[model samples]
Target: MAGGEETRKSTDSLAQESSIIDTFAPEARFECPICLAWLRDPVVTACGHRFCRGCIYSWLEREHACPVDNMKLDVEKDIFPDNFTRREISQQKARCPYIVRGCIEELSPLDVESHMIICKFRPPELPENEKLRCQFVDVGCTDKFEDEPELQRHLESEVTKHLSLLSQAYTKITISNQASTSAIAQQANFWDPPAKNEQVSTSEADEGVNALLRAMYEKIVVLEQKSREQDIIISNMSEQINSLNLSMSKMQLRHCNGCYLWYINDFKNKIKDMQKDHHLMFYSPGFYTSANGYKLCVRLNLSPRDPNYIAILIHMMKTEHDNTLEWPFSGRLSITVIHPIESYRNIKETMMTRPELEAFKRPVQDLNPRGFGYTEFVLVEDLKIQEFMRNNTLVIKVQAQPV
Candidate 1:
């Protein structure tokens, strides 16, 4: 019986403590309908309803009716401060919501809101299962994982891919930075300002001018360097194009059986220097006769050793397929000195090669010394006539026919 009575007394004490807490607890009427918390700065509506002044004011912005009664309300005239209700709430003692989290302080209604904002025990608004994104999101890593551990694992697994993306981004940034730096460097005014007249001195003026000139010179040098680089690249490309053309011509010559025509422009200018020089002669580069591969060239002497007239010659040259060709060549050649005036007839000359002629024979070396030609091909004075010289240019045409 003694043990049972002691147990009952312990239960009574617990019941009494619970009763005391209920007696001090804020009533539902003292709570705001919007926040469901003890009203702060309590205000009463025309319908005799109480709510926190801030809550009602914010609600009235989006609505005209009261949250509880759904009755029409006016924010400017229907709500009045209830100082009595505010005082009652402030006087009531409230246990901290974080009591379970080890908060030991008791607070009034007025201080609870401020405490909760800084409370360490407040539950996180976001759920723990929600994913976290990568810190490198700006660089294009869009990966999200359940938590920090998973995110770390993802980063480790994709390290190579991430590094490559970072490298590309870094390269772009570097290029942009270089361009910006170059632009800034070119603007001399951005770095130095003009001096005032009163502060100017002969030495100072000279230094400033020299600095400006130096900046200008540096910019010019950079531009000139870029221009030279571009020129070199263009020259290389031109050389390659010419090489390709020469190769294509050689290939076509191996299969072509048709006669080849050669046209030389600015003929007078080309021979003028040769005429003045003791050399007195000009030789064209070799060209193929036919697919059988007979190579020949045309030569001109402005002032021959004879000195009476202009000399013309035709000679044979070594060829890769010389062994496959007829030993002594037999062909016809035509040369025309075109008159600049369209009305004038062109001067023409023709020659028929024979197997017995040394000029028609296969070359022993790269070229032969003896060639077939007329020493008195044309009068030198006739070539100097105005009709043959137009705009300081002359045109010569040569055709080779292989039978």
Candidate 2:
């Protein structure tokens, strides 16, 4: 009687401490046998047992057996539920069948679904098996995509990785075309002259002809343009050379002569006379006497009455040959008239003796002129002669001997 009474009290206390009615209060609820968590999508086995979705899913992974009675279970078999008894049982707390402890408070019907998914005490969510028979199970993919169709849809419509690939292919093609064109140009440059009898197909021959014509036309155009430009440059250079020659031909007078003269003829004979009389001092001391001397002197007879009284100028003018002229120095004629006082006195004596001769002779011959005059010329350097006038001239001036 004592043992029996003690058992009754213990059982009553156990029932009071954990009752489905008190834990769940007003709604249907249950704990999973495998995980000791609230039942979500609770399903019954063939043996009239129930468990949570995740708990059973995991248990089925390794061994298909019921946790409570070790009853053999078939996954393919549909779960048959007794809803009337489940509703009644849901109102009271039942002892957790799990080997581990479960939630202290019984779960409400609404919370049961969420509880099973994340319950720490619940068995691990099973790894899906993708064997031929398990078509619905997606093993390695964890994208929240349920099936192959969803994964395929995501890859094709959303990602469109192939479009990027096509763009890359087109870029590669463009680069290849440019490289091929460059290579062809380089090869053409490197090709040696071909043999006359090289055989070629009709199509290849036509293509080659077209290519050659195009290249030849381009080259011809370039050459023509270059030739035209070069011609213009040469013409301009020639004109400049001519102008420079003309400028270089200009000669400055050394005697401070205000006038300039250009001789159009050779004055070699007149020049020889001037040298013999020593009237023109420009000849280097021994130049006229040299064996090879071919010096030129020009003489122009001028009456003191002539509007241009340049006798002394002729004496003072410096001279140079065109071939020997240089920059800053020019071809000019210079004459130095030596008026010896003794000769003038003698002439005076003779004139005084012969009145007739003296009548024709100018008394000034015995006297010195009031002042002297000089001549100037324009000439060029020897180096620039070829560029100047093609022909040269010289002039000579001879003073009349005193009557």
Candidate 3:
């Protein structure tokens, strides 16, 4: 019984094959020599032979000859449609190409191409179950599975192993990228050509270095200008500071007590100005008394009323401390005039206050001048001949001793 069943199956298969073969006529009139299939859109050539329109046209392009007899043919003028043969072929039934895969459909020759498109057994599409591969295939994973779910299960089972591989891959990629970047940077910073002569390369390198130096020089110039501006600002500040110091020194001089030294510069110019004004006297600014409560100054006369002599005088002035001082001032006064010549003795004088002397009288009011001095303080000829005018300056020292 098993042998009989096998024989029957074989008979069915042979019948199906025979049925498919019969659809295309074995006769030469229906068969196209090009494709050996039943003629589609049959057309007759000038040589009295028929072929499918496309087959004849393609054949004519290469040789201008009829495919059957090698007869020379003109494609546009010799080919004519064999409408009767086309209609006969269209009515002939053909088995589907998928008949071996259990498709049982039969269609006319004209409808076969369209029917094959929708044929159920035309190698049914690979299901999702059989289309999966390992997710790491791009990273050298060669494993595959029957389905996506199976692949996912495999991945989960070997997750730790896969992760280690991924880490190694990532490290390699990172290192490669870093190396590539470094190579690019090296290429960018230098102009080393493999084929160029050493001398040429060196010359090019020198030019690049010179360009860099020029840029640096320009920056330095800008910095230098900024430095100069800062210097100017500092210089102005220094001048202001010096002017303030000078003002403070003058203030200190105005308030000093005891002995004070005075320097007279431009003595010749001062003397000339006084001479022009017919005023021979020049007074020093007020200095404090030794007691620090009274203000006094000195007067020097370059040309006194006596033509051959110079004169010196002393004066006292009212002050804010007047009300706190003892009345009827009594003090010893000493004065020295410095000669420019070091070897010469400085003119020195001292006097003790006396109530009877008008110059020593107590102040009745501010500027009630009762001053005292010598009419012939020094000889003018001695000043000119004795080197007493060095660098047009004169120095004088004065002291006051309160009794």
Candidate 4:
């Protein structure tokens, strides 16, 4: 009775933690079980629960059970990308993070950051009432709309009109400043002190010149602001693209039907760099043994003891299937250095999972601290002479399966 009561309490606590719903979104379905937040890059488990890709991976590093129910899950087979849920969550309207500062704009996830970049309310000094002005009101343009989308459309459609206003201002400023060019050149702005001999600009004509200069300065400031916004948008887009590319590449490596190939590029540079950094190493993206099997990764580095040779190690990675799969996983893990045109020249080694070794046991962390494999996989000179490398690139294939 005591053990059963304890189990019930544990289950109830996990359920409560996982159910901390996000009130910001329209529905609770988008919340990640592990993160207690809106799921980004969501994935679904076989049990039909959704989680953020990163959150689930991090969670599985320590616990092999589902966050919601403590049910076992297989990282390889049970987990699938929840594209539908991701789309739904992204499309759901969300308020600006700066909404507390008077930004009344609500935007989809896709446009929120870009909108935030140019949000007039984002300026701390601007009053709530002042942020309601049109985007170009400072540039001699009329305030036409108060609606955010309507304001955007007006800005887009009225570019010519806005330009005309600027041109007219520039022309007027040019004519007015002609008489004061010498005076203006001597001083920077209305704020700047006059020359020792010159008087203060309180006269009507002098006031007119200062106003034109201020208008010109406003135009310059607006242009600079627009340029910086573009730069931020570009930087954000670049980061998103890089992240997408990285995720795609890792997925390709992680889910390649169990047979994984690692391409070591700039081989000569690696060798040279290895000399300076004796512990220099490269890790292959984590791969699975089967669709529902053990997750593993390979490590390659130059032998610290024998500089002429390379070292290779295979590490068991913690996965959601830890509870279901065999502990001290039994299998034959092999690594082969390929000689594409000459199959016989490939250097190969096969290691059996020793039951007594910690390297073969269920990983206690995201990656097992202990690794098993060859310390001297092959000689550098031998690989160079054996037609092992192609285009300064070396390829290795790793395969794991039950005996």
lDDT of 3 by residue, 90-158 (tens): 667766655534566777765665676676654333232233345554334557664445667989898
Q: Pick the candidate with the highest TM-score.
A: 4
Ranking by lDDT: 4, 1, 3, 2
Query: Judged by lDDT against the true structure, how good is candidate 1?
Result: 0.65
After the best TM-score superposition of candidate 1, give how far the Cα of residue 59 lies from its true spot, in angstroms. Answer: 57
| Candidates, ranked, TM-score | 4, 3, 1, 2
Residue 227 CA displacement from its true place in model 2, Å: 1.4
Which of 2 and 3 is the better model by TM-score? Answer: 3
Which residue pairs in model 1 clash with each other?
none
Which whole-number lDDT from 0 to 100 does residue 247 have in model 2?
Answer: 53
Off by over 4 Å in 3: 1-225, 236-244, 247-256, 340-344, 354-370
Over 144-260, each residue of candidate 4 has an lDDT whose tens digit, in order, gives 443345667888888899888656544555434443333333222332222222223324334444465665676789999999999999999999999999988867765776689
Candidate 4 runs further than 4 Å off: 1-226, 273-280, 290-292, 303-306, 340-344
Candidate 2 per-residue lDDT over residues 1-403, each given as its tens digit: 4554445444433443344224333333356667665565677888877776667868987888887788777777835554654564466443222212233345545454456445554333223321111111111112334443454575566344545543433333221122212333422422311211232343333333344444555678999999999999999999999998765543222221322233433333433444455434232111111112112223343223431222322211223332342222112223322222222311100111122322222223322122122332221232123222223333222221111
Model 2 stretches with alpha carbons more than 4 Å out? 1-199, 251-403
* Pick by lDDT: 2 or 4, better one: 4
lDDT of candidates 1 onward, in order: 0.65, 0.38, 0.64, 0.70
What local lDDT score does residue 15 receive in model 1, on the 0 to 100 scale? 43
Between prediction 3 and prediction 4, the one with superior lDDT is: 4
The stretch of ten residues in a row with the least summed lDDT in candidate 3 is 191-200
TM-score of each: 0.40, 0.22, 0.41, 0.43
User: Judged by lDDT, which candidate is best?
Assistant: 4
